[model samples]
Target: MNYNQPTDVLLIDDDVVNNFIAETLIKRASKHTNITVCLNGRDAIEKLLSIKQESGKLPEFIFLDLAMPVMDGWKFLDEYHRLNIGDGSNSEIIILSSSVFRRDIDRALKHSVVKEYISKPLNIELIRKVLKIDHHTN
Candidate 1:
């Protein structure tokens, strides 16, 4: 993926501090992208649906958290795929969670919508890899 192109990113996490930290890391990783934050899965789903309906395009990328109130990442993925949210090759998903279970990784990979699985303590290295940004500047 070209990190220089403007990409729309949706970040869904229940924890405020994690959200803030992740967003900051992402921003540092790639300056050419836009990040939108949602506190929970339900809200993320609603916002994503609305954005798609209004803009005729789903977000280029999504970073999801596995656990939360109202709805969880698994539920969101179910709903998203059920809705056929991807607009061909333009959309992708990345799962962000504290879960280190093999089952979790397996489940994430099983879904066609998901493109990558990442663990917590979000930092510059993960961001660089995910965004495919060069590290020479750092």
Candidate 2:
């Protein structure tokens, strides 16, 4: 698989601090990425639907948090599955959560839509690894 950074990335996390940190890390990892932040899963879903309807293209990557108010990541997954947006190539979802429980990790990995899972406090290294971006800078 190509490890090039994507043009568009969506971040679904309720915590403002987490979102800020993750966005910053992503920017540091790849300056070309355009990051969008959603405070809850519901809004994220809505935004995605709109984007699909309008542009017929989903975001290249989605960094999702497991716990949120209006709609949790699990619920979002259920609803997203119903949408059947992409052909499993255009968009990839990564679960970014603080939950270390084996069950949560297992459940997330089992989902067809979820590509990977990462613990909270996203960093530059994790971002590069997840996005498959090269570490060496010219």
Candidate 3:
């Protein structure tokens, strides 16, 4: 990876263990990036908004959990798109939930800011796949 290329990522989950595991996997998948985790959607939104306000350096990607307390992924997506993060470059949100229900998937697909959906227990391969997909799409 190019040292100059930014690989910052944001993870939002209520479970601490899940957050740690996801962050660790991301780090293992790519050594040249910075990863930040938020315990819930509300916190993640605040942090992201602050980043935009302070440094204008929002994370390139956001791994979001749907069934979180305080604020859920759907609410986050609503607020996120309302911000109008144009060009979709501020951050790309990927739903990282254990939910496999078709209704949940359908709802995720309806959101413009939601780039993709990922399952729990993130792995290096999945991270790589995300990178590749984003690279290709972008």
Candidate 4:
């Protein structure tokens, strides 16, 4: 864990607009942040596996959406746990889904990788307050 290294954040969502918004907010929160956006869970899984293979470095944080076309967040989590590529502790996963169902929230909370669950339309405030990023700077 090199504090000097730029923090990497991965966003797994199908919505291009949401990705853009999340990316923008993340950049504002921390200029040093490096964000990777995947359209679906499958793509995200492939990207993560590639990262693991090449650099052996996983993203510091992941913002996951439950609803997707190819592979949803639930299936992704199942595979994520099965693959065991992530150290579980290094990459902190936060569910950023639009679903407000208690069942959905409960299921996500049960997952070991998931640290927190947030409602969609991500904002800078949640990034700072909930995640405690607080606009990190050099």
Among all candidates shown, the one with the greatest lDDT: 4
RMSD (Cα, Å) of candidate 2? Answer: 2.0
Tens-place lDDT per residue, model 4, 1-138, is 243668889999999999999989888877778899999999999999999989998998899999999999999999999999686448889999999999999999999889999998788989865446635532
For residues 1-138, what per-residue lDDT tens digits would candidate 1 score against the true structure?
Answer: 564467788999999999889888888877777999998888988898898789877777799999988999999988888877664646778999999999999999899878899988888898888776677743
Pick by lDDT: 2 or 3, better one: 2
Q: lDDT-based ranking, best first? A: 4, 2, 1, 3
lDDT of 4 at 36: 94
Which candidate model has the greater TM-score, 1 or 2? Answer: 2
Error of 3 at 107 (Å): 0.8
Q: Write the per-residue lDDT of candidate 3 for residues 5-102, one digit (tens) a residue.
A: 75888888999999888888777767677988898889988898888878887788888999989999888888877876434365677899999999
lDDT of 1: 0.85
User: Residue 84's C-alpha lDDT in candidate 4?
Assistant: 94
The true-structure Cα RMSD of candidate 3 reads: 3.6
| lDDT measured at residue 61 in model 3 versus the true structure, 0 to 100 | 83
Q: Which residue window of length 10 is worst by lDDT in model 4?
A: 129-138
Compare candidates 2 and 3 on TM-score and give the better one: 2
Model 2 lDDT-worst window of ten: 1-10
Give candidate 2's total backbone clashes. 0
lDDT against true structure, model 4: 0.88
Per-candidate clashes come to: 0, 0, 0, 0
- Angstrom error of the Cα, residue 25, model 1: value is 0.5
